[model samples]
Target: MFLHLGGSTVISLKGVIGIFDYSLTKTNHVNNYFNNGKKIIKICEDDEFKSFIITNKEIYLSPIAANTLKKRINSQNFTEKVNILQEHPTFK
Candidate 1:
């Protein structure tokens, strides 16, 4: 499954480590350290960033809210599970 961060940015869900509220970065030193040297790909055009997505290979700054992104992930999980169940012999 793939998750859309915003704009044209779509990432593989398998590689995603976490999705976090951008505001947390303001107070978290660990987040600050990650931002110091890593290349952050901003998905939105404007400077307003509501969330950040941490993946296996890259970090993304997204304009979409963290809750929205989380919902998307949850929905994907639900759909995938349904598909798997439908493919089972018992479902046939």
Candidate 2:
């Protein structure tokens, strides 16, 4: 499953697992809207921005990539990273 978190970035939940065990359990108890599976691709950390691009189905930023994306997000530069991803083609 994919989600659009307002910006141009995207998140893919397929086969992905939650970082915290409690979150996983809590999420599983909720009424799933997508019914895609037991996975969460979208997350928001304190003091950080979160966004997604549903069309591409990829997670753009997390705490791991926050440092790199901070300046870009501040400048509203989204497509540059997407373009870089397309050009390099790393993970699925």
Q: Rate the local accuracy (lDDT) of all candidates.
A: 0.69, 0.31
| Best of the candidates, TM-score | 1
Task: Give one digit per residue, the lDDT tens place, for model 2 in 1-92.
Answer: 34233335344433222212112222432224224442334445533533222222322333333233334443553332332121111221
Error of 2 at 80 (Å): 32
Clashing pairs in 2: 5-52, 9-52, 9-53, 10-53, 10-58
Cα lDDT, model 1, residue 44: 77
Error of 1 at 4 (Å): 0.7
In candidate 2 the C-alpha lDDT for residue 28 amounts to 36
| TM-score computed on alpha carbons, candidate 2 | 0.21
Deviation from native of the Cα of residue 39 in model 2, angstroms: 19
Give per-model TM-scores: 0.73, 0.21
Which one is best on lDDT? 1
Residue 81, candidate 1: alpha-carbon lDDT: 24
| Model 1 TM-score, all chains together | 0.73
